[model samples]
Target: MSQLHALAAAAGVARTWQDADGRDQVVSDDALAAVLAALGYQADDDDAASASVAALSEEMSRPPAFLSVDIDAPLALPASLAAAEAAELTMEQGERRSLPIVRGVLPPIAEPGYHRLQIGEHALVLAVAPPRCLLPADLPGVARKRLWGTAIQIPSLHERPAPYGTFADLREAVRLFAARGADAVAISPVHALLSGGTSFYPYSPSSRLFLNAMLVDTSTADAGLSDQKEQELIDWPSGLASRQRELRRAFADLTPEQRQEIDAWSERQGSALHRQAVFDALSLHLDERDWRKWPADYAHPEAPGIAGFATEQTEEIAFHLFAQWLAERSLAAVQGEAKSGGMAIGLIADLAVGIDPAGSDAWALQGTMLTGLTIGAPPDPLGPDGQNWALTGFSPQDLRQSGFAPWIATLRAALRHAGGVRIDHAFGLARLWVVPEGRLASEGAYLSYPFADMLRIIALESHRAGAVVIGEDLGTRPPGFVEPVTDKGILGMRVLWFERNGNGFAPAEDFPAQAIAMTGTHDTATVAGWWTGRDIGWNRRLARGNWHNEETQRMADRSALWSAIGSGTPQPSADTPAPVVEAAIVQMGRTPSVLAIIPLEDLLGLEEQPNLPGTIDEHPNWRRRLSGPLADLLAEPATARRLAALIEARRA
Candidate 1:
């Protein structure tokens, strides 16, 4: 191998890869160099490369601070600690054990937790994980072989004059769905976003560690604010401004005892919460969007100037802390309502693949987050030029060296108030396509991560929370990826649109019993929209694709889907999409998969999708609200029949 290729290999950068078209593609030297630099390695010259390689060698020689292994699995000790005869192990529950190390293989641990291990003078955390996540069959009180659920965009349930939905609305939704035999209500990411901004995409979160404060229910803290007429779409900028005003007024009205309560709760959140609160306050005070543009000293969370800034902005920071508290409590109430309503697995939370580079997660967790690199997909049929999501992710080396603290924290946050979590773009856990700043998305390299360790950590957290885990493993995956994921008891997603059998839709029984079946996702065209070629119209209007060809294909797809639903079923024309939508829901529900989830849009026969990929403002993405209150949502005859059909299908 060439010197650069050797260095890249050592650093976990893929030199060559297979493309979507099954063609061999090589990472350009320029791209490799840029990625290596982002990983803190100098690769401009041979001398620099040698020095960096030597540095990596030295770092590898050092023992890791932590080790993760499956329960009852023997772990090989690091070479440096192999000479030790016996080690002392301390369980998380305060129990201790002294086990002999036979030929450098530590005895298997029967329990799963963060246990301490001491060998001679060296100490490390030994994280023992269960073999798999908590599955539906494993859930207590859940006896059914097939479970059904409905997915929704949280903001789409707005029935009041608040312009956007609140947790109170979500609570009502949980009761409504649970009454209809649904076990889960999967919702979009509630992760924090840039407040008061026109863009309200949930996936581009400012911080995954905290909930979106704008989604709080402020009816009790109305503060006599003027009300706007309820509309079909959310006015995010105005709605968030009103929410901010209401929250501020509520804060001002807090008594001394209430303030003390909030202070005590904030203290329990630890340093991460403090950093997030500081970031929110400083961003508003400086009137800046990105912290990188802030005056140098105030940019970092722990810089010298940050101390004085926090002192000067005490009230502002406290207000943010208070808002977060309210958001958490509000969401908790929704989950409580779901469980109390007799749902087996309620509120399946969505975890976005990455965070906006300018967001709070990047600023607060700088020690682990990668800089000057954005994550996205390589060239695919849908995106000929490749796609850049403009999001930042964790550094593989830092994750290993830091004991996967950031990863564990993110998982806990997602699973905090939900009985399940669906990981978006789960392919990221194994490898991420990282593009350097100022480079084309096509010029990106696949950076390898510690997949085994991360998966074990996920299993550990899933068991601890007693939450079922689902991975969005839809796109092109690495070789041998699905086996381990299924072995770990993580449910893989099987979307209806992509389940093709030759030139036709696949039979419902074809789906694996271990996976979750879905009629559609937030990103895809709804069943009604697909039946009527609504997506083709949008693509044509936006010049995204050849609309003429797509329209021709849609006609054939309609017939195929109709045939797959049932023999002798007549295909519905473009003008009549309601029957198709109903059939699609029932068809997905009849799958042999563990769970079947239909989007609210499809359940209601709505023609527009919640989101149209590849468009920022061209489409009304993430802004549409449901037509009626969730309580009366089932009043629609079509919706009622479709849901009843779903329940019957699942029973089959």
Candidate 2:
């Protein structure tokens, strides 16, 4: 083997990967060197490669600070502590016990939590996790046979007072869905994005630790900010300006009691919340969104000057703290309302795959986060050039050393007020395609993660939060990925467009019972949109590809879908999609999957998707609002009929 290949192997970088076409794609030597360099390895020459390999080995030889093991799974002690005869184990709840190590193997922990184990002078955090994540059937008062929900883009609610939806609107929608016999409402990511940025993509969050303060309802405070006229698309810039103005006014008007309350709540959140608030304030003060552009001293969370800045900018930081507090409280209320209104699973929050490279998470966790690397995909059939997401995530080595602290915190934040979580691009947990910054995405290598360890941590968190975990495993998963994911009780996604049998759609009954069935995701075309070739129209207008061929394929797909739903039902013309939309909803509902989520667009028979994948500015993604109030929309005869059909099919 080449020295570079040895270095790459030592660094957990894949030397070769399989592309979407099932062909082996070898990672170029240059790509491996680049990826390894990003991982802090200097492998430009054979000598450097050997040196870096030795360094990595030395690092790996050291005992990890933390270890995650499935409950009842025997754990082998680190070599340093292997000779210890006995170890003292401190449970998370302050309970302590002495354990005998039988030939370096510690007995399995029956309970799941972060426990401290001490062997002589060596100490490590042992995370005992449940065998699997919480299942949908395990949810109280939920029927295992069939459960259903609606997927909504929170901003699309478009209620009064504010042009875009807030948690207030979300609460109303959740109640409405619960009344319609829905068990859950899977909503788009509400992770904290830029405070007043031009880009309004929810998936690219500033931080996954905190809520999006802009989504908090400040109307109750009568902040006196002018409300924009209700429109089909969200004017993100204008709306963000209004939101900031409103938040400032609301913060100024906070009573002494309110200030004390927010301070107390912020205190409970600890340094993570404090750091986030400081980042927001610093951004406003420096008038720079990118932390890298900020003066070096003030950019990092632990920088000496940052503490002084936080002290001096107390008022501004307070406002951000107040904003976070309000957002969390509002979302908590929505979850509460859903549960009280008879929903079994309530809200299922979407966890974005990664955070913006220039965002707060990147700034705060710079040491553990990738610096010169960004996450993306390798060249595939769908994206011949591959795709760069311009996002950064935690380092696998750092995660092991940090006891998975950041990851656990992120999971806790996502499940804080929701009954479940849908991990976006869940395959990323096993491995992430990492590209060197400024490099073409195709020039990337797959970085292996501690898949088994991460899965155990996820299960531990899931059980602790009593939340079901649904992995968005819809696309090119690694070989042997699904079985482990399934074994861990992480529900996989089954989308209507992708559930295929040759040219025809798969039978509803054939869908896996452990998966979550959905009509479509925010990125895909809506049912009505697909039937009428609205997506193809966008592709043609954008000059994305040969739209004529896409249109022809869509026509055939429409026929195949109609047949799968039932040939007895008359096929509707492409222009008339109401019948097809209704049947599609019913078809997905009939799936044996524990959870079926129909996007609101499909339920309303709307011919527009919330997002178009390729076009950012050209497509009004994440901005389109519902035609009317959710309650009224649900009351419409057509929507009501489709929903009723869905419920009936689920029950059947």
Candidate 3:
């Protein structure tokens, strides 16, 4: 390997990668240099390459904050901790005991969870995880072999909340679904998003640790603001402002005791909460959306001035905290309702792959995040030019240095209010494709992550939460990755469109048991839209270059899919999709997967998808609302029959 290639390898970048079409693709020297530069490495010359490699190697060799050990597996420690005269072991529960380390290797741990090992000042968290994660069947009330649920973009849901479906509205819908024998309600990502942009898209959250407060139901007995009955789509920038105004009103009316409790809660959240509150206040005070453009003193979370500002502008800080509290309260209420309604798994939350580089999470967690690189995917058949999500993710190096605390916290937050979690872009666990700040997605290369350790953390958290885990491992995963994923008890996702057999889709009976079956995800077209070739129209209108030329083939794919589902409907054209919709859904429900999640759009026969991967503004992604209100929509004669057929399929 060349010096640059060595540096790339040292930094965990794949030198040569294969594209989606199975063609071998190599990262050019120029691309390698750019990616290296983005990772904060300088490889302009041979000397620079050697220095970068040495530095990266040194960092990689350093000890991590925690080591994951399977149950009954021995944990080896550095000599310093092992040689200490006095060492203590603190289990996940409050139990503590002395340790007798033999030759830097501790005895096998019998239980799973976080165990603190301390040898004087040399201490570390020993994450003892289960051999695998809990399965969906492990949850209560799931008497049937297969579990099924509806996926909802909760904010876009109507009536369930009275006005617009906020978190409150969603709870109502959940109750209705629970009554209909649904086990779970898999919702879109509720992670906090950038307030000023089209933040309606759930995938591009600002912080995985928090919920999007704007989507909280703000209706009152008295008219504060008129109902937004204009269109199904939302104007996110304006919507956030409107919601915040209502939150302000709620905050202004806070009683003395309420204010005290809020203060205590803020204190309990500690630095992370305070830092976020401070960031919000600074952003509002500066009237700037991007934190990067803020004054130098206000940009860094740990700067001395931030603490003082939080104290000076106490109301602004409190406002943000109150909003977070509202979000948490609303979410908790929904979960409580789900549990009370006798559902096995109440809510299944979606966790986004990364956060925005110019958002709160980035400012607060600057130490654990890479500075110059953005996560993206290489050019594949899905998008010929590739995909740059423009999202900032954890630096694998920083994750180790920080002992993976950020990841643990993120997982806990998502699982806190839900019975299960869906990790978007699940392949990111093993590796991620990273591009330089200014480069196209095609210019990126793959960087390996700490897969086993991260998965262990996930398993540990899921076990503790008593929640099932699902990975959206739809695309190309690392070779031999799925076995361990299944072994760890995490279910992988299987979409109706992708569960293929020799250039066609597999029969429903052939779907894997260790997976979550779904009609389509938020990114894909709804069943009606897909069967009717509406997706082809959207793709043709928005897709650039040769990507849209396959409309004829896509139409053929629809026909093949209908046949594979055994719908018995003649090759349906754009004129008729009702029969295919009924059969397609029934086929998905009959899959062997423990969990079957049908998107609300598919359930209602909506034509537009919540998101289209490549097109942002060109498509009304994440803004489409279900037809009519929740009650009216679900009460439709057609919808009732569809639900009946789906339940029959699952029970069959």
Q: How accurate is candidate 2 locally (lDDT)?
A: 0.88
lDDT of 1 at 329: 94
Query: Candidate 2 or 3, higher TM-score?
Result: 2
Q: In candidate 2, which residue pairs clash?
A: none
Per-residue lDDT for 1-652 in model 2, tens only? 9889998988889999988878998989988999999889998999999999899989988867987788888898778678889989999999999999999899888988899998888789998988899898887877455999998888888556575788888998988888878899999899998765675799999999999998888775333322454566788887787777788888898999999999999998899899999998888888889889999788688888998998898998999999999999999999999999988889999999999988899998977898799998888766789889999999999888888889999999999999999999998899999999889999999998889888988898898889999998978999779888999999999999999987589989899999999999998989888989998998888988788889888878888889898547778888898888888899898889999999898998999898887567898988887777788888899989999999999999
Off by over 4 Å in 1: 220-230
lDDT of each: 0.88, 0.88, 0.81
Query: Which segments of model 3 are wrong by more than 4 Å?
Result: 76-88, 94-105, 118-121, 160-164, 196-198, 221-227, 543-549, 567-573
TM-score of every model versus the real structure: 0.98, 0.97, 0.94
Error at 613, model 1, angstroms: 1.0
lDDT tens digits by residue: candidate 3, 264-325: 98788878877777777787788786888877778687776887897899888888888888
| Clashes (candidate 2) | 0
